[model samples]
Target chain A: MSIETDIKQKKFRSPYQRLALNLIYTSNWIQYQQVDGFREHDITSQQYNVLRILRGQYPSPIKVSDIAERMLDKNSNTSRLIDKLLAKKLVDRKSCPNDRRAVDVVITEAGLELLKKLDPVVDEWDNNMNAITHEEADLISSLLDKIRESKNNN
Target chain B: MSIETDIKQKKFRSPYQRLALNLIYTSNWIQYQQVDGFREHDITSQQYNVLRILRGQYPSPIKVSDIAERMLDKNSNTSRLIDKLLAKKLVDRKSCPNDRRAVDVVITEAGLELLKKLDPVVDEWDNNMNAITHEEADLISSLLDKIRESKNNN
Candidate 1:
């Protein structure tokens, strides 16, 4: 199905316009799909992202700034997001022992268990992309990397 | 220049994984840029999207469902978004003359004025694509189109 039919829009001004719309559209589409997967466990995609990040730092505490820096959406209010996860006991936060200005965050055992369950679901979620072959996926990946390359100089 | 440095990530399992991350990361980057542009005018990207949809239906009111159907992010709450636009006096909403169950929405003069003001900003936004040549833009666009084409059968 063309994007025209997908959104019921007639046409785009140019392919760049089309690409811009499509990147946002497809990314949002995949995000919603991921959200649905997380819904079974009553978590939003952002929460899941936080959980994964915390898991990466399991056994070692990480600072809020570090998590925010590593997040897919860098500007996300991770302080608030961590607060939410803390409310659910999926993550534990405390003032850093050596650096009081920073807060330490770590995933809990329950959180790890939850992610263990979610791992298979995430795999299946990526399976959604099986429609595109690995070759196409690689090509698209390289192109996107190139697209962001210019931002490096600035 | 690589996504590795851009996000400061250590590794990806495969190009497919990288593509997935890049799509989401780049899309959000573009959206945040637009958000800054829209914020200067006191409107959000979602609000701008709604006003554009209403303009597409000028002289004939459109329904909340119609707006949802045409939105880039279908999961967004159209009713709530429209309510915000209504509060701002950017749009008018009333019961459809033909169907009381349906609400009709149309952009007000103020809304069109806002859009007119936003037009050049949007064009400048598009011009940012000049970072990628027309040829690269087309390639990116085609690649994204193909990516979504796989979504059709599902």
Candidate 2:
């Protein structure tokens, strides 16, 4: 449905404003869908994001700052997020051997197992976007990249 | 920067997966920037969203369900969100004149004043998107709309 119909708003002043609102609205919608999927496994989306990042590292320990830089929400407090994960025993933290200021994080066996269990769920959840076709998906991705392209020059 | 550089992840199995991840990631990035702006005003982004919806109703009393329907996050709990706004005195609620099951809500004077104070902040906040040009923004918006469009059978 058009955002206009979806929200029952009368009209947007301009395509620019519409685009801004649509991007924010659609993204939040997708996030909520993902969040609900994660809830079945007893995890928040951010926690799932961290687990994915750690899984990417696998046997190698990742630094907290590195994880922060890689997070979907860039400005998130990595230290605090890591603290939450640590409490859940989903990840392990240790002082970086080279830089004491950095903390090395590794996904635990339990964490990897959880992700393996979640692999099908992740597949099913993202597949919800099957409402969209591959061509449109590629187009959307390219457009999003273009939206952030200006940030590249800076 | 690309989500690749931002997240330090190397691979995406397909453009579809890449687009899904990019949309979610870029949207979150934009949201974080917005949250920082709202944070300065001591309101979370979600709270600010509620205030804007209420302001749209102005003198006309809106119901909790109305606000929820118009919200950007479709699944948000309108009653709970309103409870927070009510506690903050940013909104006034009374028993609906016609529907006992519904509560009438209006932006309080304080709420309108606060939003007025936030006007410049919102404009300044929008400038952060100067990272993206107006044309790019429009294209991005159109692409997202298409992404949500379904092929007849799906």
Q: How well is candidate 1 docked (DockQ)?
A: 0.55
Measured with DockQ on alpha carbons, how good is candidate 2? 0.46
lDDT of 2 by residue, B11-125 (tens): 8755666776887787776777778777767787778888988887788999988888888887788888888889989999899989999999999999999999987767654
Per-residue alpha-carbon lDDT of model 1 for A1-154, expressed as tens digits? 5666777777666666677778888899888878777887988888888888788767898899988887889889998998889988999888998988999999999999999999877776565677677887777666667666654445
All candidates' lDDT scores? 0.81, 0.77
lDDT of model 1 at position B100: 88
The window of 10 residues in a row where model 1 chain A has the poorest summed lDDT is A145-154
Report the C-alpha lDDT of model 1 over B46-122, residue by residue, as the tens digit: 99999988887887899899999999998889999998999999999999989989999999999999999988878
Categorize the docking of model 1: medium
DockQ of each: 0.55, 0.46
TM-score of chain B of 1: 0.92
- For model 2, residues A68-135, the per-residue Cα lDDT tens digits are 87888876788888888888898999999899888899999889999999887777655666666677
TM for candidate 2 is 0.82
Poorly placed runs, candidate 1 (over 4 Å): A149-154
